[model samples]
Target: MKINPKFFIGLGLLLIIGYFLQDLVLSDSQYIIGVKKKRQEKDDSFRRVNGSPLSQAQRDTFKNLPYYAPDRAYRLDAQYQGFTLRDTLRMATTGPQPEAYLRWGQATFILNKQEYKLTLYRRAFGTDTTLFIPFADRTNGLATYGGGRYLDAAVPAPDDTEITLDFNHAYNPYCAYNNSFVCPLPPAENRLNVEIPAGEKAFHE
Candidate 1:
């Protein structure tokens, strides 16, 4: 049977639309998958490397690290409030010595109608590109680590006021795993009163 030219054109258009629709649906799934993959890789590295914070005994019996269920809502867009006079903050660590970090700025975001702010920081020395955020939520000492979790974000552009905070990517400090390591304690300003049910949970012994 001879097919009409219009039929072929219509079929092509339908195929194109379907392709885009599938892409849109898969984009979110793909992003979540990437997050999970990165976490798994990090866990694998800790277990495999001898220099990792995890003791050999812990690694010997290690199966998998605990994590909260990934929720899209936990990934939020935030407004960056830059500080004019950057303060030098001396952060207490698990060890006797404290690490110095620059008080870069704060990022404000609203969750459940509650406006929350997280103080961002950078290493006092070297070319700092990472925006470090150590935060404690209500989940601490319960579902998550008591000392709190960390979320690293890219430094926002000088003129850019918007940034993304993915709490689902939050991770515990090395001190949570072993006492031999020194991890910076989250500043009081970074603590959240609300329960953050996403990201790494309390480590199993």
Candidate 2:
């Protein structure tokens, strides 16, 4: 799916800012991403020793798998109520609504008479209600290595008017691309029956 011009521009601006202030970020891979990267490196090393070499799939192991792949795309344009935020490149929306929460951000729902659950986590920012939602799907290991995609969205502010949950910016968690990254698994409440073809796809690696 094509990204909106405003969103792209915003991303470019953010990247530029990040680039300009490289030292501002501490040197540390995210927990899940860090673990994933290490795993990928180990796999690559093993492949090298086997003389098979890392293929594109393996190489892609270092790339965070997004949902906006060739097959699917998600749009970040949903407002439940009293929330005004933009879904950025790290948002992953829930699927199969009416599902009960088994736990925090984890629950099950009925889909086509069948039941499925999902695990949703967020890397929140700021002291306010804003959050960074980055997630991967169950397809990550199979069709997409089970590493879902990232859908960055603006969280509803306290007593806010609206919120924007765009799936168009869904991306893969950092762990999808690299094993050195530590990423959160779908909490059983985020799983869906329908293969959400709105975000990044499986990493080739």
Best by TM-score: 1
- lDDT tens digits, residue span 1-205, model 2: 9878999899999999998677434332243344345445544553452543344556544443333322111322232342234232233223222222112132233434555433333344434333444344445556555655554445444455434444434555555555655555454435454655554456564
lDDT of 1 by residue, 1-205 (tens): 9999999999999999999999977987987898889888988888886667888898988887899878888999999988889999999877898899999888999999999999999999878679999999999999998998999999988888988999999999999999888899888899899998998999988
* C-alpha lDDT (0 to 100) for residue 55 of candidate 1: 86
Output the worst ten-in-a-row residue range by lDDT, candidate 1: 46-55
Clashes of each: 0, 93
User: How well does candidate 2 match the true structure, expressed as C-alpha RMSD?
Assistant: 15.7
Q: Candidate 2, overall lDDT?
A: 0.44
The ten-residue window of minimal lDDT in model 2 covers 95-104
Could you tell me how far off, in angstroms, the CA of residue 47 lies in candidate 2 after the best superposition? 22
Q: How accurate is candidate 1 locally (lDDT)?
A: 0.90
